[model samples]
Target: MSDETMRWAPAVPAANHPGGALRRWASGWWSVVHLVLHPLALALHVTALVLLVTGTALVPVLGIGFLLLVPARLLVAAGAHLERYRLAAVLGVHVPASGPCPVTGAWWRQLVLDPRPWRRAGHLALVSTFGVIGAGVVLALAGTGLAALAAPAVSAGLGHAGEYSWPFGIPGTLHAPALLVAAAGVLLLALTPPVARAFTAVEVLTARALLGPGRGEREAVLRRRVETLTETRSRTVDSVEAERRRIERDLHDGPQQRLVSLAMQLGMAKRALDRGGPDAAREFLDAASSSASAAISDMRHVARGIHPPVLTDRGLDAAVSALAAASPVPVDVEVLLPAGGRPSPTAEAIAYFCVSEALTNTAKHARASRAVVQLWHEAAPGAGLLRLRVSDDGVGGAAPAGGSVADGGSGLRGLGDRLAAVDGWLHLDSPPGGPTVLEAAVPWTVGGDR
Candidate 1:
């Protein structure tokens, strides 16, 4: 799909919304609220660290060392999680969760070896110290401004002759301009939000540096991503092989066998003709013709299952409709693709496959008499997205969430693997004793290689 179609899709960056500037400006001061707990959080973290060290030092003395070590470890882990959550809650900055240690052994051993939580625990030192400074600065700017702004009103209430009162009844040697002080107050007040925002930005950067993945962790993440991609690719290839084998089996059992019989009949017809048995030849020819036509029709059916010409020419609406038409159970199809909004071939094929597989699963396991299929194109981040949905009313819970084919449900695990190959995703909802719904979404950019 072309980029023009992207305007019709779901979700955009939240920063693009109207009143974004005002929202951003207001959000700057939110971190100041987080500073309220900084000192207490710092104290708890310190206590945990001190106990952890003490436990480690006592390890050689006896196994009694674990008494302090276990609680300390729990405290550190819980504190890190809470800290990360606070950043997200106060400033909308999310720190990625740390992965568990790969080493095998006791849980405490894993905790002791894993450095991520410790790194986060160390960040509390900065959060407490720098956070205190930030709080002081904010209070000075905002408090000073508000107190100064209120000065003029307070001064008007005080008696002043040679001893002139300053803003709040304070005796002043020199009587400064009331207007000037109020103007300074307005200036400081104006700076408060931006200054708060700057500190928030710094704190966010610090948190990300300490609490987010480090260099080794990033390399591990990249390695895992590669492994996942390789796994998905293998699954996709396996699925393709399975489908190919199914097609070959069907052809061998159906059209191929029919063609073989038709060939024998033609030979018999020729033998009858050569022997001057005209009546026998006619009967053989008629049988051969019938077999030929049946074989041709079977071939067409197999070809349609592979890749239909109608799909290539007419898009998903007509193609999926054809699938619904051929089903044993009635299927409701709703496809609302615009005339010019044809998705990329990749998207169409994946969508077609999803719809086909979902329907098959529903028919085989759902025990339902009816099903529904819906397909549409929507705008996405980089390109258009094709959305496929299949729902059936039958004995549900055939495939509970996360249930795989091994669980005697739909083979959606394979579908998920296939979708992942294209940066796409699949979702299935099959609750026991009722309706089953399957949803898949494929983006046109990477999926289509656009």
Candidate 2:
């Protein structure tokens, strides 16, 4: 059998077996209870809908009618919500709730524009028809079953000879007639559960069709998600290209030039040695060595910017602390990573770079006397998120868009794009005064051991 079929397969033996059949029959009877109650519940919904329709119609004539719109919409939504739950609990079918209506603009306009209310109204109208029919069928079956079951007592009370006719012309008299009637009653009772379940299945199908967000809504949601992802991807690519250019420029201006100078100095030192001037040779050699050392230092700084070793060795907590200590402004650092809970290396790297970039902006642009860095891991049920907050008491009005790195916009924008690459985000709250606060968060999965 397929996985789905196997999942729903009964644990008990086949229904042909006596005990299994009895169990099945018992379950069927239990389902009858829900069917009996269904119509009464539907009746209340129908009455409420009738009143709502009347009130809505009177809206232009009476201002009071406008006041009823909100409550009426809510009442309809409530009925649909209850029906969804009822279908799940009683019929073993789940129908998801509709997406929320737009709450902006006038309430009446919102109600009129929303498709859910009208959909629910139509559903209730159909349900009312179904309920009336279902109620009549159930009452007929139940009344016939009871009459058959008590035929002897009922006939005796009415002063008639006990007689029963079942299956067309098959007639019985006296005690035999009573037994036959009672058997018919037992059969009807046994059939009730399956009958009720069949009716409930139809109702659930109706509810699923009308009460949930339809296909158009789902498509719109998907389209919005696609657009958002596309924009993010574009920004990420731009940020990466900018970063690569910055790296190339840094290498050419700093380490690459130092290495070239060191080579020139080595060539000069070789010539001095050939000319047999020991002091001159030694001076050239020292200068060359100093140049080489400077080049190495510059390369190390570049490599650190790419991925800091401190972040890998000591986790985000220690890394952020080090960053704060090195800041031009006195920075207060608070790190709250769980003892054994550290984020994945990629996540940690992204977070570290984000903070590093933010601090760079704060120090260079924000002429702040003090700053604060807060880093912590928030553990939720199924996942954890790493949160970083950087605030500076500086000349504010900082934003993630507009201006260059020198003026402090590209850096923040780059940080945002970088965070986006790792499913992280950056939020900057800097009004045109002082105290700029930059907050960032990224999904974190606990790394093994460290």
Candidate 3:
């Protein structure tokens, strides 16, 4: 499949809405309101957090002159997270609970030496800058409302500085100005959230600079890793299919053609003997029989190496049992899987080869009396994992030979490559003693037609 198709799969699943209670609950204006509010809450929380972080750095300067206020300074620094959480909830952001800031093992020494705390002190110095702006807007609205309500009362004292008016206060000569100021205050109050939101965005950007390892960057890195693994898996499957094609071509052209020619030659030899002496006939018959037997053995070996039919006809459970029955030593088979569902043809073949190679290694190297093969599907949190394990009661030491299994010692490298093609893994667990085990895990329904 193309990358676009793969990307679309998850979205289809996500778009499928759940039924019953969930559908009923989500089918209202409240849900829409909640959706809109959540982002606002997040912005508020992030902004407050930034302000708090900026304020924290100022503690050091104050501490230098008044070291006694260190405890109070620490409390003020911690209050940033607390206030962030509060704003998050009010805005409907799903914020997590937090305890004290994590302290490294050498926190006390680091606190004194690190530049971040000092930077935080600088941020803290600007705390009043934000506060003053926020407070100025709130107080301006309050003053205007008060002036509007008490317009008549403040008419005679219009030139006086301390006198204020409100819409519902005592009758005032300057009612018009007071009413206008109150109207302006009401408008400012209504506009505060959006203005605050924009300010918070700036604060979050600043906090990320001061706090280190911004959340967005962390999440982006994680996403990149997931994409890498997915693409790697896809490439691995493509390579495996390419290899199987190569092997099939090799067998069809080489051993298969040679066997057919040999059979034809034997047939011609028998016809010649029928026209000759009894002695000649017997010799030709014997030679032909021997040639036929050898060809049959060679063909069987090649066929088994390519793709064993037993694995396909009976699935992994029966195929493994047949393998154990064929082993030189007494072998056992234990299968623990669902009655059987067909995996992709490529996956099944790879699974069989993994088990066969493992057993072949054990029989050749490990001097064991008995062996066990187990097949099962491993159900994990998000994906279906199929596993096969081959164990032998033999000498444990088996490693890659001369760097390649083609040199004919242990088949580790070849087997590893084969497993990789089908998005599978082989793990060798052998300590230098009496028993060794090889485990294989293959992902199902990927690459080719499933």
Candidate 4:
């Protein structure tokens, strides 16, 4: 069998050697243990169900019994929790936990009205009731098989050769009948593992059906996700709009004014030249040239804010290195990304800006001497991720909700909004005293490899 299949499959047929047979049995031993423990689980489930039924019947007549529904529901939920753990530990079947029971108002209003508790009760009923049958058959078969296997030896050990015992009418000696019983015992032993595993699988399926989240809970989760996406998308749009307005404002204030001055200065220089005053025209030209250079520098700064030319030319590592070099505070930079391919352009931009903003925050607000910027790409649980970490040894206690000028919460909040644009995320961990760390990550794909 493939390794994946073998991981969950029951024991294979016994091998040639005793050791090999024992090893095979070891694989499915959990199944047998699970079956053996059914009585105890069945007791818990049955008690919960009894309370549920009794509470339901009594609540219609007297309100006093309505209180019993709370404990009943709690018991069933607890049993379901245990079932989840057991299934995961033994069968490796992970069932997602259902949402909690709604208890906003009266206990009867929530507990009796909600269908979730009923579903859990139904699962408990199915397992506890039908499970008894399977449990009985398995236990009986196992007990019978063990007795039959030992009958010949035990009978002979009694030192009676031909006297047949009354129990099951077996001959009390090592004869053909004894041999037949041993053969039957061997057949039942061979059948137990698969039988136990099959029962366990059925119980697991039932638990998943009723104990796991129901459709209402699933719809609630989807609704929550939609709400989150809506909020993030709105924030992303706002962030983009705010950025565009900032760029426009900066251009109007800086480069545009310089260029207007340049135009005025060149015009004066032309007028000076036309007046035949070479020295006056030469000074005007020099002032115009300086204005033009300043305008170019301002434009470059705005362009870097938009998307740095360095980031476009070099990869994320080199781009972040430039940021580190420019930061007022000393920054230790390290980038460990793939050489063959890189994250998508959007991801790289996010990383670059993340580093830039973090460094900016460190320099402006952190009041620290040193900081560190590290970026890397690695495989995550479900996909690949490009992660960035920026840490500073600064006075900590950064606020999460933004709008705190003292702690740079506003900038970090903007960082979060920016990351949410690409379904990325940012986490700021800054306690009191010192050492604040900002960790952010964005999912990436290998197809973007360089």
**Leading candidate by lDDT:** 4
Q: Write the per-residue lDDT of candidate 4 for residues 1-450, one digit (tens) a residue.
A: 554464456555568755886665665657777667667788789889999899888887767667788799889889878777877777667788888775568755786788788988887787786667677777888888998899778877887577536376643445776878899998887777778777877888888889888877899999988988898889778877888888999999999999999999999999999897888799999999999999999999999999998887777888999999999999999888876556777888888888888888788878999999989887664448999899999997675432232345555667688777566788777777768888888877423422
Estimate the TM-score of every prediction: 0.62, 0.59, 0.48, 0.58
TM-score of 2: 0.59
Query: After TM-score superposition, what is the CA distance of residue 410 in candidate 1 from its true location, in Å?
Result: 11
Q: In model 4, which range of ten residues has the least summed lDDT?
A: 399-408
Tell me the alpha-carbon RMSD of every candidate.
8.2, 11.4, 14.0, 9.9
lDDT winner, 2 or 4? 4
- Estimate every model's Cα lDDT from 0 to 1: 0.77, 0.76, 0.57, 0.80
Ranked candidates (TM-score, high to low): 1, 2, 4, 3
Best by TM-score: 1
lDDT of candidate 3 over 1-450, digit per residue (tens)? 764465355533423655643443333223223223333334433454444454445546654423423443454345444334433544333323322333456754445454444434443333335534544554454455454445444554566344444437744335465556557655654444444444444544454454443345457667976876676567556556766786788677666766776677677777777777666667656766776677677678777777787886777777878888888878788877765355666767777777787778777888888888887878753346678888888887663322223333334555665566555667777767746777777776544433
Error of 2 at 239 (Å): 1.2
Query: Which parts of model 3 are misplaced by more than 4 Å?
Result: 1-271, 274-283, 400-410, 421-423
Segments of candidate 2 deviating more than 4 angstroms: 1-68, 75-113, 117-214, 277-279, 379-384, 400-408, 421-423, 445-450
Query: Which segments of candidate 1 are over 4 A away from where they belong?
Result: 1-23, 37-43, 57-65, 102-111, 157-164, 167-176, 234-353, 369-414, 424-450
Candidate no. 3 TM-score:
0.48
lDDT of 1 by residue, 1-450 (tens): 646466456665668878887776676667657765576677777777777778777776766677888888788777778788988778767788666565578876765676765676677667667776887888789899997887766666575533446546666532465676789899888788888777777878878888788877788999988998998889889878887898999899889999999999999999999997888799999999999999999999899878888888877788899889988879999988766667777788778878888888777778898999988777655666788889988998866655544344325666677788887888777778878888888986554442
